[model samples]
Target: MHTEHDWISTPITADILRGALDLEHTAHGVLPHRLPAWARAQSTDGQLAMAEAQPSGVRLAFRTRATAVELDALPTKRVYVGAPPRPEGLYDLLVDGRPAGQASVSGGNTLTIDMTTGSAEHRPGPAGTLRFTELPDGAKDIEIWLPHNETTELVALRTDAPIEPVPDRGRKVWLHHGSSISHGSDAASPTTTWPALAASLGGVELINLGLAGSALLDPFTARTLRDTPADLISVKMGINVVNADLMRLRAFGPAVHGFLDTIREGHPTAPLLVVSPVLCPIHEDTPGPSAPDFSALGEGRLGFVAMGEPEETASGKLTLGVIRDELARIVKQRVAEDPNLYYLDGRDLYGEDDSAELPLPDQIHPDAATHRRMGERFAELAFTADGAFAGRGA
Candidate 1:
């Protein structure tokens, strides 16, 4: 007698799929009711708390059934990060733990994973689509690794499923914006970014807009958010603005207002959150040049200091603290009319306690461990059922 395996067109259930496509929900009535499809089983227990301060690695794995194989399938996989470095290798497309392909790392800093037929190499460019082909028939598991050193964000995923798209069963969508810190920097994988982790814990979709050196309340960014669809929204300000001294109070306030206004155009009643910056001793009260000190490290060492002369602060140049204070003030004013608006102090996400435990190797960005801590705090404060922003909107 001969036995043979049969191909079945069984529908994939939410329980069987893993990795970033999994959905979670922390609170019941928050704004955006869908989390990123890519956030699945993370290291964080549902508790979503932080204790460490250095960078830690995150690995996300999921299995899916393939009915057939094709040469031209544009599968969409989006990974968000806080300031992804230029030529940064953050995505590794693997099949059966073997290299399927790797994302490009270029001179410009942006976190994106797009797969195409090419040699296994890391290239760089803006955040966008990743294509994969020649998949082995049957059930295959795909793994996505996020940055290990810096924070990261995960936005969305799209694939050509012969079946109708499954309705999202997670919590509300969580939109976030910030500088490179929110972008993936020195991360080992795309799924391990802190924002991606937090979204997993909170159970919400993520719309990450953490631009490198460009989170300075740009009209284009605000317009992007305004046009995009979301249920919950957040803006992580400071750090970049202070380090770059991009604008003074005269312009920063109005610019922030305008930014929020544009977003409100799309999500008038959505829960909007405003976040400040994490702790950086060098930029605490000083400003300018957020670069690291390569010379200070003897070997295998990284050092960082606030750029520019110390006297710049005296001339009304911005500092991290200044930006935080202003952000708080702006949020307060907006909340008066927009009750759904909320504020989360950056220090709360990563404070002096964390700084003492996890000193910035370069005094500029947090390590992998710190990213985990930040993600936990964010999920706890922003996504918990009893959290501050919970139940504010249906």
Candidate 2:
């Protein structure tokens, strides 16, 4: 049912890539990295390493008359040693800034992880090819959005016609940082991630730093935001800190202040918005270190449970509700001196009412529809005429 064509190979280069901070040449091909070498070198946490390598917003952007396109990529697939298999990573195609097609590759290296033991093992495999055909005729801008949750090494690019990098369209660059929810967890594809959808609706270029389980207020991460070139910036905080139970109230306030201070160093007058956690009943009033619920493992479903006690908040434990209040207070205090700084309560994006209509399937991450809803809501609140991110020239 399939036939091979005379494909013209084109060397993949940095000029055709977008959203990635760094590109590393691997044995098979080039791997996109969300974090620079110096930033990655500062952390030994395996979670941070994996998250940064997933390339949530990375994509190939070019103009071509190619009616057919083929890409060879070796993706490092992840598997939980005992959990149900995850769906293959998806690649989304956009033509002239509109959704056109989607595809997935089959074989790649596997990284099996054991949650209980915090151990992992890697097994090598070969690259797989993805092909798209029957595209419209004439020259058009084509963008291949890489998988947000997979560590993909781009091997080869081939097409029926010559290709060239797309010229800058003068879109405003929006750099956002957040947690797993912002990292496209449970989202249908990379381009449909809340931030991606919001960027599309807002008509801005995106550089997403939504590191899963790694959005802690790290100095290096702040430094990364400080140095990156962006017209608009936002930092979504609280969810990861509460779930990880990484710090208490005493440490959280100063950490947030210091983080904001670092970012202000380079972007002195850029409109900066700090977003608090969205509604999550489990850790809203209660504190956390959340843990996996193995009771449903037999049913091929996994869920999370908050491990901390509600009373623990009396002693300075973090919770989503506490975080929202604190974040609002901090922004109000800083706004007097820093007129460009602002804040948005995450609930405005995904509140209790929205959750009632679309409950989180896993009790933490939003479903595909929720991602869309959140994206639309964000565009309304932040990109509207009188919104915080409004009035920026594209």
Candidate 3:
């Protein structure tokens, strides 16, 4: 009944299975597909199906190899946490909930999980590749969990199986540019990034160009977007520009136009949406100031001043509102000639009403729950049949 090809089909190695498995969870944060109500009714042992036919909230793929592995993969699902949970970190490789290895996340975004040690912790370093080795000959599946305190991006995995290539089904590409918030700052996972979530909801591919603190309308970033391929595009501006106070009104206006001009060089007719900043009560119209804080180290305390927040912004100067108004005026002039171009008020993405319900913990980035809400709203407004910039070629 079973053919040899099936058994020897690259052994169904991990790399081959990358981006295929997803963890579907409920609003209550429980994996429902893994714990289907019907399955629970049928058996007392309720082991949910971690790998199923439907898309998962958590997905993984492979990246590269380390310490002699047959293959490597990336995680389709990426979980993002603002801070590490413990010094030991929180990435663990569990075989049926039994610890097979340990992982530690460090430097805020890097993870070092020991597949053999059964203990992991968070450390300080840059984000890097995750490696796995010494697999049992017949191991069928593996699961990675982001512990309660830490957040992680499932960057890559390794296996020996041949990967089934994803067919390019002519899905329209959605290119997005923004700041740390767009980079997933406080979101729960990579898939939960508003752009990623919205892309999934709207059945589009995503090219997330969100860079933390680097969205100051740099010429390089503009060129990068201009050269990248895409069927549709959007630039979420304002907040970063305002926060950084990178330019004055005259410079800002020309920069916005230039950014579009650069992108137009590559995507002349693509539907381009320019989004303003979302609601930030304290900083909406207020300027920033140099604020110092005391760091309570183990032995003693240390004083430090934040790098940004110039002295001129101490009294309601250089605010997001100013940037938004300027961006809106500049985009309006450009849209006259480019009917395909569009503008989306950031308020439509996240408004004062929503902010009341989901306050920004840092007065900047939205938390995981808020990210979900923003993604849902964005899809509803921007992807609807009669939406302002809908039906453009993907």
Candidate 4:
């Protein structure tokens, strides 16, 4: 019931792309990387490498009048062993910077991951095509935002009309760094991530450094943040450190200071907002190194529980409660010396009241609805007049 048009296959090259800092040509196609090649070389582990290449903010952007389009991609979708099935990785299409349509390709491949065993299995599959038909006539910019959580390889781009690079519109750049939540945890798609959504609402170009399981106040990450150009910047702190129980109180404060110091080294006056972690009742009072809820595992449900007792905090263990207090203190102390520095409590984005109505489904990551709430609240706080980062002119 479909008729074929004369498809123009465009070269899948980096010159026609944005958001991705580097692209690796694979045997089958090209893999987009959010981090640069030099930074990727400094990856300490496979986890960091995977997270860096996940392309949380990467998109294929161009201007065209194509009525129909086809994109071939090979995506590695993750399936947690013994856990509930995850949604398929979604590909979102945008025309003239407006949402147009979305699609998911099945049979492309799958990655079965066993968290308990720390192992994974990859089963190869063929590249799947995403087709978009009946686009409105006339020239308009189109952006295809890849799935944030899945690793995708670009194979080919086909459109009914020729496409060209999108012209710059002189939008302010907003660079952000955070953990999984900011990295698109439980987000419906890549373009809907809190940072991405907030960027759209604020009309800023996003340079997201949201590394899952790896936003541990790393010196290199801070250096990357310092080097990236931006009109506004934010760093959502505390969640990953608390969940991983990576550092104790003694080391946490100094590490934060050093991280901010590194960023200030390059962007001394850029409007920088420091955000604390959103509420996670499990870790609110209890110190963490959160562990899996085994009871839920039988039902193929994945959830976490705070393993460390609150009493352990006296020994310098960090809890979400403790981290919030510490972050507030650090920001308050530093704001006097750095006038452009500002702090926005994470609870303001997702407070106790909101959590009561829209609880975190995994006892950690918020659901898609909550992601929308957080993004909306952030835009109000950071972009509106008289808000923390509102005074600066781009």
CA error at residue 220 for candidate 4, angstroms = 1.5
**Candidates' TM-scores?**
0.63, 0.97, 0.62, 0.95
Worst 10 residues of 2 by lDDT: 1-10
Is 2 or 3 the stronger prediction by TM-score? 2
lDDT of 2 by residue, 290-357 (tens): 88877766566768889999999999999999898889999999999999998999999999899899
Q: Model 2, stretches more than 4 Å misplaced?
A: 1-6
Candidate 3's residue-wise lDDT over 1-394, tens digit each? 2222222122223333322222333222222121123322443321112122122222232222212232111222222232223233234453432346644443333444332342344444344344445545443335443322233333333344433433445778777777767756667654666876787677776656665555667665677677767777888886766656556666777888898898899889888888888887756756543122223222232222234444444443466777787778887888888988888888888888988899876567788898898888888878887664466434
lDDT of 4: 0.87
Give the CA lDDT, 0 to 100, for residue 248 in model 3.
64
- Which tens-of-lDDT digit does each residue in 278-390 have in candidate 1? 88888887777565454554343445567766567667677777778888898887787998888888899888999999877667777778778888888889877766456
Best by TM-score: 2
Output the lDDT of residue 362, model 4. Answer: 80
TM-score, ranked from best to worst: 2, 4, 1, 3
**Could you tell me how far off, in angstroms, the CA of residue 313 lies in candidate 3 after the best superposition?**
8.2
Each model's lDDT comes to 0.56, 0.92, 0.55, 0.87
lDDT of 4 at 333: 97
Pairs of residues clashing in candidate 4: none
Better candidate by TM-score, 1 or 3 = 1
